[model samples]
Target: MTKLTLGVSSCLLGDEVRFNGGHKHHRWLTHTFGQYADFVPYCPEVAIGMGIPRNPIRLISTDTGTRAVDSMNLTDDYTERLQHYAESIVPQLDALDGYVVMQGSPSCGMERVKLYNKNMIPEKIAAGLYTGVLQRHAPAIPFEESGRLSDPNLVENFVQRVYVYHDWRTRQPWRTAKELIDFHARQKYLLMMHDYPTYKRLGQKLSNLKDIDNRGAFGQAYLVELMAALSNIPKRGHRVNVLQHVMGYFKNQLSEKEKASLIHSIEQYQASEVPFIVPVALLKHYIFLHGDQFPYLMNQTFLNPYPEELGLRNPI
Candidate 1:
Protein backbone atom coordinates (compact mmCIF):
# COMPACT_ATOMS: atom_id res chain seq x y z
CA MET A 1 0.00 0.00 0.00
CA THR A 2 1.21 3.46 -0.90
CA LYS A 3 0.77 5.57 2.24
CA LEU A 4 -0.76 8.90 1.26
CA THR A 5 1.00 12.00 2.59
CA LEU A 6 -1.66 14.69 2.97
CA GLY A 7 -1.09 18.41 3.52
CA VAL A 8 -3.57 20.37 5.59
CA SER A 9 -3.90 23.93 6.81
CA SER A 10 -2.40 24.00 10.28
CA CYS A 11 -5.27 26.04 11.65
CA LEU A 12 -7.72 23.27 10.77
CA LEU A 13 -5.98 20.94 13.20
CA GLY A 14 -6.79 23.20 16.17
CA ASP A 15 -3.42 24.92 15.75
CA GLU A 16 -3.73 28.53 16.89
CA VAL A 17 -2.14 29.84 13.73
CA ARG A 18 -4.91 31.90 12.20
CA PHE A 19 -4.58 35.64 11.60
CA ASN A 20 -6.77 36.36 14.64
CA GLY A 21 -5.25 33.45 16.62
CA GLY A 22 -8.45 31.42 16.15
CA HIS A 23 -8.60 27.97 14.53
CA LYS A 24 -11.08 26.24 12.20
CA HIS A 25 -10.21 22.84 13.54
CA HIS A 26 -12.29 20.00 12.05
CA ARG A 27 -12.61 17.24 14.65
CA TRP A 28 -13.62 14.50 12.16
CA LEU A 29 -10.37 14.98 10.26
CA THR A 30 -7.89 15.25 13.19
CA HIS A 31 -9.48 12.17 14.78
CA THR A 32 -9.84 9.84 11.76
CA PHE A 33 -6.93 10.88 9.49
CA GLY A 34 -4.48 11.60 12.29
CA GLN A 35 -3.83 7.87 12.53
CA TYR A 36 -3.80 7.02 8.79
CA ALA A 37 -1.63 9.46 6.84
CA ASP A 38 1.34 11.74 7.27
CA PHE A 39 -0.05 15.27 7.66
CA VAL A 40 2.24 18.13 6.66
CA PRO A 41 0.79 21.13 8.47
CA TYR A 42 1.11 24.51 6.77
CA CYS A 43 -0.01 28.05 7.51
CA PRO A 44 0.43 30.11 4.32
CA GLU A 45 0.11 33.43 6.14
CA VAL A 46 3.01 32.49 8.42
CA ALA A 47 4.89 30.86 5.52
CA ILE A 48 4.84 34.19 3.63
CA GLY A 49 6.44 35.76 6.75
CA MET A 50 3.19 37.14 8.13
CA GLY A 51 2.98 36.32 11.84
CA ILE A 52 0.00 35.22 13.88
CA PRO A 53 -2.57 37.89 14.88
CA ARG A 54 -1.58 39.91 11.83
CA ASN A 55 -3.62 42.05 9.45
CA PRO A 56 -6.08 40.15 7.22
CA ILE A 57 -6.09 40.20 3.40
CA ARG A 58 -8.84 39.46 0.88
CA LEU A 59 -8.78 38.75 -2.84
CA ILE A 60 -9.43 41.85 -4.96
CA SER A 61 -10.18 42.35 -8.62
CA THR A 62 -8.29 45.32 -10.00
CA ASP A 63 -7.93 46.10 -13.75
CA THR A 64 -5.53 43.18 -13.90
CA GLY A 65 -6.17 39.62 -12.58
CA THR A 66 -7.38 38.89 -9.09
CA ARG A 67 -5.01 40.30 -6.48
CA ALA A 68 -4.72 39.86 -2.75
CA VAL A 69 -5.26 43.27 -1.24
CA ASP A 70 -5.36 44.44 2.33
CA SER A 71 -8.94 44.09 3.56
CA MET A 72 -8.58 47.37 5.42
CA ASN A 73 -7.35 49.23 2.30
CA LEU A 74 -7.52 48.86 -1.49
CA THR A 75 -4.07 50.28 -2.36
CA ASP A 76 -1.67 47.59 -1.15
CA ASP A 77 -1.19 44.33 -3.16
CA TYR A 78 0.30 41.61 -0.96
CA THR A 79 -0.22 38.79 -3.46
CA GLU A 80 2.98 39.33 -5.50
CA ARG A 81 4.92 38.14 -2.48
CA LEU A 82 2.48 35.24 -1.93
CA GLN A 83 2.84 34.25 -5.57
CA HIS A 84 6.62 34.27 -5.36
CA TYR A 85 6.62 32.22 -2.14
CA ALA A 86 4.10 29.76 -3.60
CA GLU A 87 6.16 29.16 -6.75
CA SER A 88 9.17 28.38 -4.56
CA ILE A 89 7.44 26.06 -2.05
CA VAL A 90 5.16 24.29 -4.53
CA PRO A 91 8.20 22.67 -6.10
CA GLN A 92 9.36 21.24 -2.75
CA LEU A 93 6.00 19.70 -1.94
CA ASP A 94 6.46 16.96 -4.52
CA ALA A 95 5.20 14.04 -2.42
CA LEU A 96 1.76 15.09 -1.22
CA ASP A 97 -1.16 12.99 -2.47
CA GLY A 98 -3.88 15.39 -1.29
CA TYR A 99 -4.62 18.65 0.55
CA VAL A 100 -7.44 19.87 2.84
CA VAL A 101 -7.75 23.62 3.20
CA MET A 102 -9.90 26.00 5.23
CA GLN A 103 -12.71 27.30 3.03
CA GLY A 104 -13.45 31.04 2.50
CA SER A 105 -9.94 32.15 3.47
CA PRO A 106 -8.26 34.37 0.87
CA SER A 107 -5.00 32.49 1.33
CA CYS A 108 -6.10 28.85 1.48
CA GLY A 109 -9.78 28.38 0.53
CA MET A 110 -10.12 26.04 -2.45
CA GLU A 111 -13.13 27.82 -3.97
CA ARG A 112 -15.76 30.53 -3.50
CA VAL A 113 -13.18 32.71 -1.75
CA LYS A 114 -14.27 36.31 -1.32
CA LEU A 115 -13.08 38.67 -4.03
CA TYR A 116 -13.24 42.44 -3.53
CA ASN A 117 -13.37 45.39 -5.91
CA LYS A 118 -10.95 48.34 -5.96
CA ASN A 119 -13.59 50.37 -4.13
CA MET A 120 -13.20 47.95 -1.17
CA ILE A 121 -16.57 46.41 -1.95
CA PRO A 122 -17.07 42.66 -1.75
CA GLU A 123 -17.77 40.95 -5.08
CA LYS A 124 -18.74 37.34 -5.77
CA ILE A 125 -15.60 36.43 -7.68
CA ALA A 126 -14.31 33.21 -6.11
CA ALA A 127 -10.55 32.86 -5.86
CA GLY A 128 -8.00 31.52 -3.42
CA LEU A 129 -4.34 32.54 -3.17
CA TYR A 130 -2.44 29.34 -2.36
CA THR A 131 -5.15 26.99 -3.66
CA GLY A 132 -4.95 28.01 -7.33
CA VAL A 133 -1.17 27.84 -7.36
CA LEU A 134 -1.01 24.47 -5.58
CA GLN A 135 -3.62 23.02 -7.94
CA ARG A 136 -1.89 24.37 -11.05
CA HIS A 137 1.40 22.94 -9.85
CA ALA A 138 0.08 19.49 -8.97
CA PRO A 139 -2.91 18.93 -11.24
CA ALA A 140 -3.35 15.30 -10.24
CA ILE A 141 -3.53 15.75 -6.48
CA PRO A 142 -6.84 15.37 -4.59
CA PHE A 143 -7.86 18.62 -2.86
CA GLU A 144 -10.93 19.59 -0.75
CA GLU A 145 -11.99 21.74 2.21
CA SER A 146 -12.48 21.21 5.93
CA GLY A 147 -16.23 21.87 5.69
CA ARG A 148 -16.63 19.57 2.67
CA LEU A 149 -15.07 16.67 4.57
CA SER A 150 -18.18 16.21 6.70
CA ASP A 151 -19.99 14.67 3.72
CA PRO A 152 -18.95 11.01 3.72
CA ASN A 153 -18.94 10.99 -0.07
CA LEU A 154 -16.21 13.58 -0.58
CA VAL A 155 -14.18 11.82 2.09
CA GLU A 156 -14.50 8.48 0.30
CA ASN A 157 -13.64 9.92 -3.13
CA PHE A 158 -10.78 11.96 -1.70
CA VAL A 159 -9.41 8.82 -0.13
CA GLN A 160 -9.79 6.90 -3.40
CA ARG A 161 -8.18 9.68 -5.44
CA VAL A 162 -5.29 9.91 -2.99
CA TYR A 163 -4.74 6.16 -3.15
CA VAL A 164 -5.05 6.14 -6.95
CA TYR A 165 -2.62 9.06 -7.28
CA HIS A 166 -0.06 7.20 -5.20
CA ASP A 167 -0.75 4.03 -7.17
CA TRP A 168 -0.19 5.85 -10.49
CA ARG A 169 3.10 7.26 -9.26
CA THR A 170 4.25 3.82 -8.11
CA ARG A 171 3.72 2.21 -11.52
CA GLN A 172 7.09 3.59 -12.61
CA PRO A 173 7.60 3.60 -16.37
CA TRP A 174 3.91 2.99 -17.00
CA ARG A 175 3.93 0.48 -19.82
CA THR A 176 1.21 -1.05 -22.02
CA ALA A 177 -2.39 -0.14 -22.84
CA LYS A 178 -3.74 -2.76 -20.40
CA GLU A 179 -2.39 -0.86 -17.41
CA LEU A 180 -4.25 2.23 -18.58
CA ILE A 181 -7.41 0.21 -19.23
CA ASP A 182 -7.38 -1.41 -15.78
CA PHE A 183 -6.97 1.95 -14.03
CA HIS A 184 -9.88 3.36 -15.96
CA ALA A 185 -12.05 0.35 -15.14
CA ARG A 186 -11.30 0.68 -11.44
CA GLN A 187 -12.68 4.23 -11.60
CA LYS A 188 -15.80 3.20 -13.57
CA TYR A 189 -18.27 3.13 -10.64
CA LEU A 190 -16.93 6.37 -9.20
CA LEU A 191 -17.54 8.06 -12.54
CA MET A 192 -21.08 6.63 -12.86
CA MET A 193 -22.06 7.87 -9.42
CA HIS A 194 -20.78 11.39 -10.10
CA ASP A 195 -21.39 12.63 -13.67
CA TYR A 196 -23.05 10.19 -16.03
CA PRO A 197 -22.69 12.39 -19.12
CA THR A 198 -19.10 13.43 -18.52
CA TYR A 199 -18.29 9.83 -17.73
CA LYS A 200 -19.80 8.79 -21.06
CA ARG A 201 -17.89 11.51 -22.94
CA LEU A 202 -14.60 10.47 -21.32
CA GLY A 203 -15.13 6.92 -22.50
CA GLN A 204 -15.52 8.22 -26.04
CA LYS A 205 -12.35 10.30 -25.74
CA LEU A 206 -10.38 7.29 -24.62
CA SER A 207 -11.86 5.03 -27.30
CA ASN A 208 -11.32 7.40 -30.24
CA LEU A 209 -7.75 8.58 -29.66
CA LYS A 210 -5.57 8.84 -32.79
CA ASP A 211 -3.01 6.10 -33.12
CA ILE A 212 0.44 7.62 -32.65
CA ASP A 213 3.74 5.86 -33.38
CA ASN A 214 5.43 6.90 -30.15
CA ARG A 215 4.53 4.80 -27.10
CA GLY A 216 5.69 7.40 -24.59
CA ALA A 217 3.50 10.14 -26.07
CA PHE A 218 0.52 7.78 -26.13
CA GLY A 219 1.05 6.88 -22.45
CA GLN A 220 1.32 10.56 -21.54
CA ALA A 221 -1.92 11.27 -23.37
CA TYR A 222 -3.48 8.31 -21.59
CA LEU A 223 -2.58 9.75 -18.19
CA VAL A 224 -4.02 13.12 -19.16
CA GLU A 225 -7.31 11.54 -20.22
CA LEU A 226 -7.37 9.49 -17.03
CA MET A 227 -7.41 12.72 -15.04
CA ALA A 228 -9.79 14.38 -17.50
CA ALA A 229 -12.16 11.43 -17.27
CA LEU A 230 -12.45 11.97 -13.52
CA SER A 231 -12.64 15.77 -13.73
CA ASN A 232 -16.41 16.04 -14.38
CA ILE A 233 -17.32 13.84 -11.45
CA PRO A 234 -18.29 16.16 -8.60
CA LYS A 235 -16.25 14.83 -5.68
CA ARG A 236 -18.90 15.08 -2.95
CA GLY A 237 -22.46 13.83 -3.56
CA HIS A 238 -21.58 11.13 -6.06
CA ARG A 239 -19.24 9.50 -3.61
CA VAL A 240 -22.03 9.17 -1.06
CA ASN A 241 -24.35 7.62 -3.63
CA VAL A 242 -21.73 5.01 -4.52
CA LEU A 243 -21.23 4.15 -0.85
CA GLN A 244 -24.99 3.62 -0.38
CA HIS A 245 -25.24 1.17 -3.31
CA VAL A 246 -22.29 -0.74 -1.95
CA MET A 247 -24.14 -0.94 1.38
CA GLY A 248 -27.18 -2.49 -0.37
CA TYR A 249 -25.32 -5.71 -1.02
CA PHE A 250 -25.32 -6.52 2.68
CA LYS A 251 -29.13 -6.23 2.78
CA ASN A 252 -29.62 -8.85 0.04
CA GLN A 253 -27.54 -11.44 1.93
CA LEU A 254 -29.51 -11.21 5.20
CA SER A 255 -31.77 -14.05 6.46
CA GLU A 256 -35.60 -13.65 6.77
CA LYS A 257 -35.51 -12.71 10.47
CA GLU A 258 -32.44 -10.51 10.10
CA LYS A 259 -33.93 -8.88 7.02
CA ALA A 260 -37.13 -8.05 8.87
CA SER A 261 -35.21 -6.01 11.45
CA LEU A 262 -33.17 -4.10 8.82
CA ILE A 263 -35.84 -3.68 6.08
CA HIS A 264 -37.12 -0.37 7.48
CA SER A 265 -33.64 1.01 8.04
CA ILE A 266 -32.63 -0.14 4.56
CA GLU A 267 -35.69 1.57 3.08
CA GLN A 268 -34.35 4.97 4.18
CA TYR A 269 -31.59 4.42 1.59
CA GLN A 270 -34.19 4.76 -1.21
CA ALA A 271 -34.47 8.47 -0.48
CA SER A 272 -30.65 8.71 -0.59
CA GLU A 273 -30.83 11.51 2.00
CA VAL A 274 -29.38 9.71 5.04
CA PRO A 275 -25.96 8.19 5.57
CA PHE A 276 -25.73 4.52 4.45
CA ILE A 277 -23.09 3.61 7.00
CA VAL A 278 -25.53 4.40 9.81
CA PRO A 279 -28.14 1.82 8.72
CA VAL A 280 -25.51 -0.60 7.44
CA ALA A 281 -23.91 -0.65 10.87
CA LEU A 282 -27.28 -1.44 12.47
CA LEU A 283 -27.76 -4.37 10.09
CA LYS A 284 -24.25 -5.63 10.84
CA HIS A 285 -24.91 -5.57 14.59
CA TYR A 286 -28.18 -7.47 14.09
CA ILE A 287 -26.50 -10.13 11.96
CA PHE A 288 -23.06 -10.33 13.62
CA LEU A 289 -24.73 -11.15 16.97
CA HIS A 290 -25.70 -14.51 15.42
CA GLY A 291 -21.90 -15.06 15.09
CA ASP A 292 -21.76 -17.53 12.17
CA GLN A 293 -24.78 -17.27 9.84
CA PHE A 294 -23.32 -14.55 7.61
CA PRO A 295 -19.70 -14.46 8.71
CA TYR A 296 -18.71 -13.18 5.26
CA LEU A 297 -20.66 -9.99 6.03
CA MET A 298 -17.30 -8.74 7.27
CA ASN A 299 -16.08 -8.99 3.64
CA GLN A 300 -19.33 -7.58 2.26
CA THR A 301 -19.65 -4.28 0.40
CA PHE A 302 -20.71 -2.65 3.63
CA LEU A 303 -17.26 -3.25 4.98
CA ASN A 304 -14.82 -2.57 2.12
CA PRO A 305 -15.15 -0.18 -0.81
CA TYR A 306 -12.15 -1.41 -2.76
CA PRO A 307 -11.41 -5.10 -2.49
CA GLU A 308 -8.47 -7.09 -3.86
CA GLU A 309 -10.93 -9.37 -5.61
CA LEU A 310 -14.11 -8.19 -7.27
CA GLY A 311 -17.35 -9.07 -5.44
CA LEU A 312 -20.71 -9.02 -7.29
CA ARG A 313 -21.92 -6.86 -4.42
CA ASN A 314 -19.62 -3.98 -5.43
CA PRO A 315 -21.41 -1.26 -7.36
CA ILE A 316 -18.61 -0.85 -9.88
Candidate 2:
Protein backbone atom coordinates (compact mmCIF):
# COMPACT_ATOMS: atom_id res chain seq x y z
CA MET A 1 0.00 0.00 0.00
CA THR A 2 1.20 3.53 -0.76
CA LYS A 3 1.86 5.58 2.34
CA LEU A 4 -0.37 8.63 2.87
CA THR A 5 1.18 11.96 3.76
CA LEU A 6 -0.74 14.57 5.78
CA GLY A 7 0.40 18.07 6.68
CA VAL A 8 -0.49 19.27 10.16
CA SER A 9 0.13 22.41 12.14
CA SER A 10 3.11 21.96 14.47
CA CYS A 11 1.16 22.97 17.56
CA LEU A 12 -1.04 19.92 17.14
CA LEU A 13 2.03 17.72 17.46
CA GLY A 14 2.64 18.97 21.04
CA ASP A 15 5.29 21.35 19.82
CA GLU A 16 5.32 24.75 21.53
CA VAL A 17 4.68 26.40 18.20
CA ARG A 18 2.11 28.89 19.34
CA PHE A 19 2.78 32.59 19.85
CA ASN A 20 2.65 32.01 23.60
CA GLY A 21 4.65 28.81 23.23
CA GLY A 22 1.84 26.45 24.10
CA HIS A 23 1.05 23.23 22.24
CA LYS A 24 -2.41 21.93 21.43
CA HIS A 25 -1.21 18.30 21.21
CA HIS A 26 -4.21 16.47 19.87
CA ARG A 27 -4.03 13.03 21.48
CA TRP A 28 -6.29 11.21 19.04
CA LEU A 29 -4.24 12.32 16.06
CA THR A 30 -0.92 11.46 17.66
CA HIS A 31 -2.26 8.07 18.68
CA THR A 32 -4.11 7.12 15.51
CA PHE A 33 -2.74 8.65 12.31
CA GLY A 34 0.77 8.57 13.68
CA GLN A 35 0.68 4.82 13.04
CA TYR A 36 -0.20 5.09 9.36
CA ALA A 37 0.47 8.37 7.58
CA ASP A 38 3.67 10.30 7.77
CA PHE A 39 2.81 13.59 9.50
CA VAL A 40 4.69 16.67 8.32
CA PRO A 41 4.44 19.40 10.96
CA TYR A 42 4.73 23.07 10.05
CA CYS A 43 4.96 26.27 12.11
CA PRO A 44 4.83 29.38 9.97
CA GLU A 45 5.03 31.75 12.93
CA VAL A 46 8.13 30.13 14.30
CA ALA A 47 9.77 30.29 10.90
CA ILE A 48 9.16 34.02 10.69
CA GLY A 49 11.59 34.96 13.51
CA MET A 50 8.55 35.41 15.72
CA GLY A 51 10.38 33.12 18.18
CA ILE A 52 8.52 30.64 20.31
CA PRO A 53 6.98 32.08 23.50
CA ARG A 54 6.52 35.40 21.77
CA ASN A 55 3.83 38.07 21.78
CA PRO A 56 0.33 36.88 20.86
CA ILE A 57 -0.84 37.73 17.34
CA ARG A 58 -4.22 39.20 16.58
CA LEU A 59 -6.59 39.17 13.54
CA ILE A 60 -7.72 42.68 12.68
CA SER A 61 -9.87 43.83 9.76
CA THR A 62 -9.74 47.50 8.90
CA ASP A 63 -13.29 47.33 7.60
CA THR A 64 -16.06 44.71 7.34
CA GLY A 65 -16.07 40.95 6.70
CA THR A 66 -15.58 41.52 2.98
CA ARG A 67 -12.58 43.70 3.72
CA ALA A 68 -11.59 41.75 6.88
CA VAL A 69 -7.98 40.71 6.57
CA ASP A 70 -4.97 39.55 8.59
CA SER A 71 -2.33 42.13 9.45
CA MET A 72 0.43 42.78 11.96
CA ASN A 73 3.49 45.10 12.39
CA LEU A 74 1.83 47.75 10.21
CA THR A 75 2.83 45.57 7.22
CA ASP A 76 0.64 42.76 8.57
CA ASP A 77 3.92 41.16 9.62
CA TYR A 78 2.43 37.86 10.79
CA THR A 79 0.37 37.34 7.65
CA GLU A 80 3.27 38.36 5.45
CA ARG A 81 5.69 35.95 7.10
CA LEU A 82 3.11 33.16 7.06
CA GLN A 83 2.43 33.83 3.40
CA HIS A 84 6.12 33.71 2.48
CA TYR A 85 6.66 30.52 4.45
CA ALA A 86 3.53 28.96 2.98
CA GLU A 87 4.54 29.87 -0.55
CA SER A 88 8.04 28.53 -0.02
CA ILE A 89 6.66 25.15 1.03
CA VAL A 90 4.19 24.80 -1.81
CA PRO A 91 5.85 21.55 -2.79
CA GLN A 92 5.10 20.01 0.60
CA LEU A 93 1.45 21.02 0.40
CA ASP A 94 1.33 19.63 -3.13
CA ALA A 95 2.66 16.30 -1.86
CA LEU A 96 0.06 15.93 0.86
CA ASP A 97 -3.35 14.29 0.48
CA GLY A 98 -4.78 16.33 3.35
CA TYR A 99 -4.05 18.59 6.35
CA VAL A 100 -5.19 19.05 9.93
CA VAL A 101 -5.30 22.71 10.95
CA MET A 102 -5.60 24.24 14.38
CA GLN A 103 -9.17 25.30 15.07
CA GLY A 104 -8.90 29.03 15.94
CA SER A 105 -5.41 30.41 15.85
CA PRO A 106 -4.79 33.66 14.03
CA SER A 107 -2.10 31.75 12.16
CA CYS A 108 -3.68 28.28 12.01
CA GLY A 109 -7.38 28.47 12.75
CA MET A 110 -9.66 26.86 10.20
CA GLU A 111 -12.77 28.98 10.88
CA ARG A 112 -14.23 31.76 13.00
CA VAL A 113 -10.91 33.02 14.21
CA LYS A 114 -10.85 36.04 16.47
CA LEU A 115 -11.11 39.35 14.61
CA TYR A 116 -9.79 42.21 16.68
CA ASN A 117 -10.60 45.93 16.41
CA LYS A 118 -7.74 48.32 15.78
CA ASN A 119 -8.60 49.83 19.17
CA MET A 120 -10.91 48.66 22.00
CA ILE A 121 -14.06 47.68 20.08
CA PRO A 122 -14.32 44.07 18.79
CA GLU A 123 -15.12 43.64 15.09
CA LYS A 124 -17.76 41.41 13.51
CA ILE A 125 -15.64 39.47 11.03
CA ALA A 126 -12.83 37.13 12.01
CA ALA A 127 -10.92 34.98 9.56
CA GLY A 128 -7.90 32.79 10.15
CA LEU A 129 -4.62 33.77 8.53
CA TYR A 130 -3.24 30.28 7.97
CA THR A 131 -6.60 29.10 6.72
CA GLY A 132 -6.55 31.79 4.02
CA VAL A 133 -3.06 30.80 2.94
CA LEU A 134 -3.80 27.11 2.77
CA GLN A 135 -6.99 27.73 0.84
CA ARG A 136 -5.22 29.92 -1.69
CA HIS A 137 -2.11 27.74 -2.12
CA ALA A 138 -3.87 24.39 -2.32
CA PRO A 139 -7.49 24.90 -3.14
CA ALA A 140 -7.99 21.24 -3.93
CA ILE A 141 -6.35 19.91 -0.80
CA PRO A 142 -8.83 18.54 1.74
CA PHE A 143 -8.35 19.88 5.29
CA GLU A 144 -10.14 19.79 8.61
CA GLU A 145 -9.56 21.37 12.01
CA SER A 146 -7.97 19.19 14.69
CA GLY A 147 -10.89 19.70 17.09
CA ARG A 148 -13.54 18.50 14.61
CA LEU A 149 -12.05 15.02 14.33
CA SER A 150 -13.67 14.08 17.63
CA ASP A 151 -16.88 13.39 15.77
CA PRO A 152 -16.26 9.86 14.55
CA ASN A 153 -18.24 10.46 11.39
CA LEU A 154 -16.13 13.46 10.43
CA VAL A 155 -13.00 11.53 11.33
CA GLU A 156 -14.01 8.65 9.10
CA ASN A 157 -15.05 11.01 6.35
CA PHE A 158 -11.69 12.77 6.25
CA VAL A 159 -9.81 9.50 6.51
CA GLN A 160 -11.84 8.05 3.68
CA ARG A 161 -11.13 11.15 1.62
CA VAL A 162 -7.40 10.77 2.16
CA TYR A 163 -7.43 7.08 1.38
CA VAL A 164 -9.61 7.61 -1.67
CA TYR A 165 -7.27 10.30 -2.95
CA HIS A 166 -4.32 8.07 -2.22
CA ASP A 167 -5.98 5.21 -4.04
CA TRP A 168 -6.59 7.50 -7.01
CA ARG A 169 -2.93 8.52 -7.08
CA THR A 170 -1.62 5.00 -6.68
CA ARG A 171 -3.89 3.57 -9.34
CA GLN A 172 -2.99 6.25 -11.86
CA PRO A 173 -0.68 4.02 -13.88
CA TRP A 174 -3.45 1.56 -14.72
CA ARG A 175 -7.12 1.24 -13.91
CA THR A 176 -8.62 -2.17 -14.44
CA ALA A 177 -12.18 -3.41 -14.31
CA LYS A 178 -11.40 -5.16 -11.05
CA GLU A 179 -9.89 -1.99 -9.60
CA LEU A 180 -12.81 0.14 -10.74
CA ILE A 181 -15.29 -2.29 -9.24
CA ASP A 182 -13.39 -2.28 -5.97
CA PHE A 183 -13.11 1.49 -5.83
CA HIS A 184 -16.80 1.88 -6.59
CA ALA A 185 -17.61 -0.69 -3.96
CA ARG A 186 -15.87 1.30 -1.22
CA GLN A 187 -17.38 4.53 -2.48
CA LYS A 188 -20.92 3.27 -2.95
CA TYR A 189 -22.28 4.26 0.43
CA LEU A 190 -20.30 7.48 0.47
CA LEU A 191 -21.85 8.29 -2.91
CA MET A 192 -25.54 7.80 -2.04
CA MET A 193 -25.15 10.53 0.56
CA HIS A 194 -24.05 13.25 -1.83
CA ASP A 195 -25.20 12.99 -5.47
CA TYR A 196 -26.28 9.65 -6.92
CA PRO A 197 -26.34 10.77 -10.54
CA THR A 198 -22.83 12.17 -10.44
CA TYR A 199 -21.53 8.92 -9.02
CA LYS A 200 -23.19 6.90 -11.74
CA ARG A 201 -21.97 9.24 -14.43
CA LEU A 202 -18.42 8.90 -13.20
CA GLY A 203 -18.85 5.16 -13.11
CA GLN A 204 -19.99 5.20 -16.69
CA LYS A 205 -16.93 7.22 -17.70
CA LEU A 206 -14.72 4.70 -15.92
CA SER A 207 -16.08 1.95 -18.13
CA ASN A 208 -14.29 3.56 -21.06
CA LEU A 209 -10.98 3.87 -19.24
CA LYS A 210 -10.12 0.22 -19.71
CA ASP A 211 -10.64 0.35 -23.48
CA ILE A 212 -8.68 3.53 -24.31
CA ASP A 213 -5.10 3.17 -25.60
CA ASN A 214 -3.67 6.44 -24.22
CA ARG A 215 -3.00 5.30 -20.70
CA GLY A 216 -1.55 8.61 -19.47
CA ALA A 217 -4.21 10.93 -20.81
CA PHE A 218 -6.89 8.46 -19.87
CA GLY A 219 -5.55 8.26 -16.33
CA GLN A 220 -5.51 12.06 -15.90
CA ALA A 221 -9.05 12.40 -17.23
CA TYR A 222 -10.27 9.61 -15.03
CA LEU A 223 -8.82 11.29 -11.92
CA VAL A 224 -10.66 14.55 -12.60
CA GLU A 225 -13.96 12.73 -13.05
CA LEU A 226 -13.44 10.27 -10.23
CA MET A 227 -12.37 12.87 -7.67
CA ALA A 228 -15.30 15.12 -8.55
CA ALA A 229 -17.74 12.24 -8.24
CA LEU A 230 -16.40 11.04 -4.90
CA SER A 231 -16.04 14.49 -3.35
CA ASN A 232 -19.71 14.90 -2.49
CA ILE A 233 -20.30 15.99 1.10
CA PRO A 234 -21.96 13.40 3.31
CA LYS A 235 -25.24 14.48 4.88
CA ARG A 236 -28.18 13.18 6.92
CA GLY A 237 -30.70 10.85 5.06
CA HIS A 238 -27.60 9.17 3.70
CA ARG A 239 -27.58 7.27 6.97
CA VAL A 240 -30.49 5.23 5.71
CA ASN A 241 -28.75 4.68 2.41
CA VAL A 242 -25.51 3.68 4.10
CA LEU A 243 -27.34 1.46 6.57
CA GLN A 244 -29.26 -0.33 3.87
CA HIS A 245 -26.11 -0.98 1.90
CA VAL A 246 -24.28 -2.22 4.97
CA MET A 247 -27.23 -4.44 5.80
CA GLY A 248 -27.21 -5.95 2.36
CA TYR A 249 -23.70 -7.09 3.02
CA PHE A 250 -24.76 -8.81 6.22
CA LYS A 251 -28.33 -9.92 5.53
CA ASN A 252 -27.50 -13.30 4.12
CA GLN A 253 -25.38 -14.26 7.10
CA LEU A 254 -27.75 -12.92 9.77
CA SER A 255 -30.70 -14.79 11.20
CA GLU A 256 -34.13 -13.26 10.56
CA LYS A 257 -34.41 -12.07 14.16
CA GLU A 258 -30.91 -10.62 14.04
CA LYS A 259 -31.75 -8.92 10.74
CA ALA A 260 -34.85 -7.31 12.26
CA SER A 261 -32.88 -6.10 15.25
CA LEU A 262 -30.17 -4.63 13.05
CA ILE A 263 -32.68 -2.90 10.83
CA HIS A 264 -34.46 -1.50 13.87
CA SER A 265 -31.17 -0.18 15.16
CA ILE A 266 -30.63 1.55 11.87
CA GLU A 267 -34.04 3.21 12.15
CA GLN A 268 -33.19 4.45 15.59
CA TYR A 269 -29.95 5.79 14.18
CA GLN A 270 -31.74 7.69 11.42
CA ALA A 271 -34.15 9.25 13.90
CA SER A 272 -31.37 9.95 16.36
CA GLU A 273 -28.06 10.44 14.51
CA VAL A 274 -26.77 7.95 17.07
CA PRO A 275 -23.64 6.10 16.11
CA PHE A 276 -24.06 3.50 13.33
CA ILE A 277 -21.80 1.26 15.36
CA VAL A 278 -24.63 -0.41 17.30
CA PRO A 279 -26.32 -2.13 14.37
CA VAL A 280 -23.02 -2.47 12.56
CA ALA A 281 -21.35 -4.04 15.56
CA LEU A 282 -24.21 -6.47 15.91
CA LEU A 283 -23.91 -7.40 12.27
CA LYS A 284 -20.14 -7.70 12.53
CA HIS A 285 -20.55 -9.89 15.62
CA TYR A 286 -22.87 -12.09 13.62
CA ILE A 287 -20.29 -12.23 10.86
CA PHE A 288 -17.61 -13.34 13.29
CA LEU A 289 -19.90 -15.87 14.94
CA HIS A 290 -21.20 -17.13 11.64
CA GLY A 291 -18.05 -16.87 9.56
CA ASP A 292 -19.14 -19.10 6.71
CA GLN A 293 -21.91 -16.78 5.50
CA PHE A 294 -20.37 -13.60 4.03
CA PRO A 295 -16.69 -14.20 3.62
CA TYR A 296 -15.92 -11.89 0.73
CA LEU A 297 -17.61 -8.76 2.11
CA MET A 298 -15.91 -9.11 5.47
CA ASN A 299 -12.69 -8.07 3.77
CA GLN A 300 -14.26 -5.63 1.38
CA THR A 301 -12.81 -2.13 1.70
CA PHE A 302 -16.29 -0.81 2.36
CA LEU A 303 -16.80 -3.15 5.29
CA ASN A 304 -13.41 -3.46 6.87
CA PRO A 305 -11.89 -0.25 8.21
CA TYR A 306 -14.21 2.58 7.17
CA PRO A 307 -17.54 2.55 9.01
CA GLU A 308 -15.86 0.86 11.92
CA GLU A 309 -13.16 3.49 12.19
CA LEU A 310 -15.84 6.13 11.81
CA GLY A 311 -17.60 4.58 14.83
CA LEU A 312 -20.35 3.19 12.59
CA ARG A 313 -20.22 -0.07 14.54
CA ASN A 314 -23.03 0.72 16.96
CA PRO A 315 -25.35 3.66 16.35
CA ILE A 316 -24.31 7.23 15.47
Evaluated with lDDT, which candidate comes out highest? 2
Question: Candidate 1 residues 1-316, lDDT tens each?
Answer: 5456888989988999988989988886777666567788888788888878887988987687888877777576778888877787686556776788998889888888878776767865574888888878766667888877766555665665666666665664546655555555556555665566665766676565444435466655655555554545354355455545544545565677766656655556545545555554665575566535544444332244432231212121
lDDT of 2 by residue, 122-239 (tens): 5434546766777766655668888888876667767767777776655645555566556665666556555677667767766655544565665555555555555555555665
Candidate with maximal TM-score: 2
Backbone steric clashes in candidate 2, count:
17
lDDT: worst 10-residue window of model 2: 64-73
Name the TM-score of candidate 1.
Answer: 0.69
As for model 1, its CA RMSD to the true structure in angstroms is 6.8
lDDT of 1 at 128: 81
- In model 1, what is the error at residue 172, expressed in angstroms? 3.7
